[model samples]
Target: MASVTFRHTSVTYPDGSLGLADIGLEVREGEFMALIGPSGSGKTTLLRTLAGFITPSQGEVLIGDEVVAAPGRSVPVERRGLGMVFQQHAVWPHMSVEQNIAYPLKLAGAGRAERRARVAEVLELVGLGGFGSRRPSQLSGGQRQRVALARAIVRKPRVLLLDEALSALDEPLRADLRAQLQAMSKQLGLTVVHVTHDRSEALAIADRIAVLDGGRLQQIGAPDELIERPASPFVARFLGDATLLRGRLENGLFHAEQVPLAVPAARITPGAPDSTQASMDVTSASGPASRGPASSSSAADGPVNRNAPLTGLLAVRPEQFRLTAVEGSPADDAAGETPAGTSPVNGGAGNTPSGGNAADHLTNAPSSRDASTATGPGARVTSGDDDPPPALIPASAPARVLSSLYGRHSCSARIEWSGLEFSCETALWRPQPGQAVRVDVTAGTFYPLSAAGSTPAARQEGEHAA
Candidate 1:
């Protein structure tokens, strides 16, 4: 097993197209790390750099403390002692499965008997035991992929690199192969760096995940850390079902043109003469809470001032918002009434509560919600039927349903509110096209972002496609 390290590495094309920028990371021996991001996010470039296919223009790349890439040095791909699996599978069609898997061993000048033994062992390892004599054209797509995987690992290299290796397979096949890959990595103590745009796949397979965007390293942490407490709006939106709103931070409140959102704290001081400390505090509804710094007041308090003029953004995940039907509104006509026990909150989206202890009262609730059933039009289901209704906080944003798409049990509704379109998930209840829905931005996980002198940008729907 071997470890990989990037020391402020960067890669830039001759035409000034940046591929990677000042990335520094460390992957421990036998660690499984996933690189995930949108298109043009440098995930593939980073993987290529590790495999010695692309040399860095600045800094260095190391594998097991040996410099493989740097400004003045380069290691040939073959001498790096690594195995790579590409998206195309790349199995030789004319060769039998055993021949293909043993090709690497033969090239390394292994004895005939040893090559045969290793081929047979790996054939069984990838579940192709009896199919070793079959040609690539005679096997299914999944089987062909297995052959390619076996070929990559036949020589037992120090590291394994997968660049969208499973993107070409169907969902069921992909799942099966993913499980196999994980098992193989653990069983062989292999160090792996897998790259893909699928956040869920990365989360499910990797021990640690690194998120990159625009050729820059955004965040690297465990799956839950990135999902629950993202360091940036881009990271949050890219990794999960999030709705980002452009707004400003003033007195610990997020103020959009037509929405009122509250966050745990304001950590950015606009044009401040002095620097302030920043930290992350995430409290999931059912999961354990995490905070970066110690505090007596609340986990949300940070170094920035409570009252400052800072333009920024807010990221609210789908599960963070509690959907409620707006009462006495034009769009409410299409909304059904609340169930007998549930109660509707007072006021519109703009009438949200300001700072003070309101942030505390609004954010703390049951850690989990029970499944709820929809009974009437516009009637929103709380987390569970037994739990009392959520506190009566005004709507953070009032929206009109533009369209509703049903899934197996949940529904995704395209809502228009304050000139912004949000593809947020709601309860299984199907709302009419014009139905009124009030979104409550619950306290604990509402993330407030400072513009940091950047442009107003938000992640669009379906950015997670692999």
Candidate 2:
């Protein structure tokens, strides 16, 4: 196991564009660090730097105590003691599985017996024990990927570099491979740096997540830590489903404009004793907010509003929203974006809280509008002779059961409440078109992301122009 470290690392390309700048990070030995962001976020660039594929214009790239990448002297990729898997399964098509796995051993000039034994061991490690003799062309996509993995670390390199190795697979196949990789990492004690843009992939697999944007590293930490407490607005919005609600704090305690809400932990690391519930906007895709001293609510709303302690930005996950068929009790807004004294759940009723947006509940929230709704033939709505066809759309805002799909053992529901699309998985649901569905959102998780830092994009752009 070898720790990979980068300090003051910066990179530039022949096109005069900057790839990265002021990079500083450390990947602990034997830990999995998943670097994620959009295509140009420099995730791949960082991985290449670690693999000794790209040279930096400034700074140090160190593995253990050795300075592998820096000014003047540099190490080559093969000499770096790192295992690498590319986006394409870079296995030699003509080589048999056994041959491919054993190739690394041969490269290191191990004798035939040792090479064969290591090949057998790694093939089983990647779950291809029985297919040793098959060539790459004979395997399924998953199988081929397994072969590729077997080849990557067959020599037991100190670190493993995965460059979106599973991005080409379908969702289910990708999920399966993710599990296998996780298991393999633990068993092998391999330090890993995986690069991808898939949010779910990063969330499910990473021990530490490094958010990169525009070729710069934004924030790095554990999965829940970054999601629940983002260091900036960019980080919050980039990682997952999150919406930014603009609000302000009054007198350093309550948010203005919306119902009274407390400052976020980012704002007041120690929320007062009375602060309890953090609110969010469900459609907003905000993450969890920090715990503070405020009246606790029944549930968290979108990290958008509930986590709305003092809102710069909120990240709300879809699963965090609580669905309701009927009206819910009123509560106060933490993010000042809500109307003064507004409660997110139920807008009106003496029992409800006051001062939220008077717009129809489905109007402002995006997830309420779904593109799909799951319904079976038998579950279709039948028109009665005496009843004029009920309006699928509301008088002003429309709600429709749009698109839905059924899997072998489960199904997903999609509905258009206002204009946004929101989907959820279920055991079974057969809601017909024009079915009146009441969506009562309980709350969302809020993550207070950093708003002050420069994203990789900015640095890259600046470097190119400079």
Candidate 3:
């Protein structure tokens, strides 16, 4: 497979202040690698750097053994032997499909006959075999993008760079095009680097994902590897729902403000960072833990190192979990009871440990519902309840439903938790406005997230730091 490597890459904008830093990476040939993160994360910048549009202030970018770029030296965007598709498709709207696809060939001085033949091949390759005479506007968004793809590959470059080329399309269409991109890469053996801010998009298409935050590489690894095991709390939140808890590890168990979690002591644990004063937004209650260093995922092939040989954990993924109503009986407590901490995890938002066990601990004691009511740190149900507190909640009720949005086959409700309101996606059928209803999350779903930078709480502190 072709390998694209970056060594200590950094970029500084004209205005200055770290556009990108300490970037080092390797992407296998015929692989789809996504550089993902929030807006200022340098995903687009990284793509531009690799494509030779922006010169790195330091370090190098390489494709296989050849050095494509090194500091001030660049091969020139055109001569870089790379195919690039931009957010706008970069297609000549007035030009016919054949003309656009043949532009690269024409620039290379391919004869009329040769260019025509190559255009035919690529047009078909992009599923536009007979549409060569069509203009850009004559095609659908997907078609235009396909034409852009055809044009990029006409030269048969070693690497393809996509700068959110399909982000503008609807979700369903994007999914179809993503599969097309993957298939094209496999058949042609082309190495590609794609950039986007959408987490699900990146995870679905990437052979590996590089998490960027404020122009810095936060973490990197295959999709599942990064998702199920983010290294830092930041990562846990950014990847998706990360139910963070403020706690310290002592005596093999983890005790947050008061919640207890069963951490596999034998496996890697969240690095003991300074716990002097920590706060969590409680983004996600439970899910799988996250790890860093960009681990490879078994989803790409078969099973991965299922025998946990890794570390740097913080729960993050939703699929890697099960549900439970409450804590189970002692007979079922195989992980053993949490080493009760000095305080209990209480308070609606910012709860402190009261320093006593005799008090009602905010112990995530899921009520015994459906025998399956297991208990873990991410206990969802309030200790005493079974099924959402009997719909006593009304508009003027304790918890009022704020907004409702419909999804393909499911729906989500924005519930006011405490004085703060957040979104919770569910399949439950509930009414509008003044509707009072009880809500509950899965206990097993709430768990500790890494300290790595995930989505900030209601308020954040970071490069956007003050």
lDDT of candidate 1 over 55-98, digit per residue (tens): 89999999998999999799999999998898897988889888
Candidate 2 C-alpha lDDT tens digits along 376-436: 4212121122211124212222234455465654344565654545553323244444444
The lDDT values for all models are 0.65, 0.56, 0.57
Q: All candidates: CA RMSD in angstroms?
A: 9.2, 12.9, 11.7
Error at 153, model 3, angstroms = 0.7
Clashing pairs in 1: 285-367, 286-367, 336-377, 336-378
TM-scores of all candidate predictions against the true structure: 0.74, 0.65, 0.66
| Better model by TM-score: candidate 1 vs candidate 2 | 1
User: Model 1 misses residue 150 by how many Å?
Assistant: 0.6
lDDT of 3 by residue, 161-210 (tens): 88888887887888999888888888898888988877888888788998
TM-score of 2: 0.65
* lDDT for predicted candidate 3 compared with the true structure: 0.57
Clashes of each: 4, 75, 39
